[model samples]
Structures are given as structure tokens and as C-alpha cells.
Target: MCSCQQHSGTANSTSAPKDAISFRVEDMTCGHCAGTIKKAIEGQLPGSAVTADPASKLVSVVGAADFSAIKSIVTGAGYTPSPDRVS
Candidate 1:
């Protein structure tokens, strides 16, 4: 599957909270990877918003999402997510 197929675009949810935390996923190589990560996080967090960019290797999560849980989700998705910056 084309990786970009899963592109969630930017955070379009005006009502959702902004990024509470961000992750540096070194292995997130393409849109597909980002999509996978995004899907996993949203699936677990429900209302949370995720912005995963392969180019920047960053995954920002907005809403009520636990840091450890996000890490676990990224890792479970077959990627190494390091704590980047928290907002």
C-alpha cells in the first residue's frame, strides 16, 4: 500500500486540543508510516488528534493522551518513538 494513502493531513479539528506532546519517530519513513501511527493513536485515544510527518520524523498528539501510551502505540506500530518536545 502507498504510504501516503493514510495521510491524515494537518490537525483540522478546530475544537480538539492542540498537541500535548510530540514524538520523534526515527523510523517513520513515509506517509504510510505516519498514517499507521496516526491511526493507532486515534484508535486508542478516540478524540485525540495526531499529526505524523515522515519528513520531520515527528508525531504530535493532541487531546487527552498519555505520554507512555503514545510511546507504546508508536512502538507497537513498529517504530522507535523518542520523547521529543512536550507542549
Candidate 2:
């Protein structure tokens, strides 16, 4: 299966939350990487709002989807999640 197909299997069916959750992404090195991460997360969690700052390597996600599952998506996209930033 392709990477996209593999990722589709991990997609979440839950609804997004009202408040946003912030996380520090250590592997987002450029604009393209940031965009890719944003798309990956939003695709996995429908209704989610994702904002990523490549300079600070911070990704804030607002949704009701499972955080652990989201983290897995980040890892699969080649980014490291900062444990301290997770709530």
C-alpha cells in the first residue's frame, strides 16, 4: 500500500473540540514540511484547525480527536512531538 493509504487507516472518526491544543513539533524544518504536517493532521481529524509555525516548530491543533492518535500521525509524518507541550 502507498503511504497515503497507510495513513488513511489511522484516520480518526471523532469530532473536533472547541478549544485548541498546542504542541511543539521538533522536526518541522521548513514551510513545505509544516504544510505537510498540517494537512496530515487535519485529514486524520476532520473539523480540526491546525496552525503550525515553522520557525518556532510549534503546532497548535483545535479539535476533539484523540491526542495520542494525533501524535502518532505527527510521528508518521517525520516529526517529533514534545511531551511537555502535550496536555
Candidate 3:
């Protein structure tokens, strides 16, 4: 798995609500894209359960984390989340 250390903030680092969420990602087109997005999320949330499916362009995250933080890491991984942001 690829290691992304540029952004390694704990999900608890924020006071915002932490819960599981499923949202569409606009640019997850391949396995590599899914893996990259997964890694990016894990990099920050550590124990967070992140499931990214290239076929569906949806990423499901279960654990602690703020929406902005999650979005930032996803974008940094070279993917754009859907316009809806969260689903």
C-alpha cells in the first residue's frame, strides 16, 4: 500500500461530529484510485474503516473524523469528491 505522510491528522483532532459516512467520489476510476483514496483516509484516521469502490465511485468511512478533514485528504490524494460532498 502507498504511504501518505504529508497529512496525518487523527480523526479525533477535530471537535466535529465523528460518524460513518458514504459519499461519491467524482474521480475514482481505477483500483489505484480506490487504493490511493483509502490510504489517504487511513493516513489520517488510522483505525478508520474506509472502503472505496472504483466501480461505484463511492467511499464509505466508518469511525471518527470531521467532514472537512476527510474531504481534504481525499482531494489531496488526487481525487475530487462528488458535488454533493456527503451522502
Which numbered prediction scores highest in lDDT against the true structure? Answer: 1
Give the number of the best model, judged by TM-score.
1
What TM value does model 3 have? 0.71
TM-scores across all candidates?
Answer: 0.73, 0.72, 0.71
Deviating ranges (above 4 Å) for candidate 3: 1-19
Give a tens-digit lDDT track for model 3, residues 1-87. Answer: 233434332222111124667678766766666777888899888878787766566787888457778888887877887655453
**lDDT for predicted candidate 2 compared with the true structure:** 0.68
lDDT of 1 by residue, 1-87 (tens): 233435554432223245367767777777777778889889988998787777667777878557888888778878888865533
Q: Which ten residues in a row have the lowest lDDT in candidate 1?
A: 10-19
Better of 1 and 2 by lDDT: 1
Better of 1 and 3 by TM-score: 1
What is the C-alpha lDDT profile of model 2 across 53-77, one tens digit per residue? 6666677788644778878888888
Residue 21, candidate 3: C-alpha displacement in angstroms: 0.9
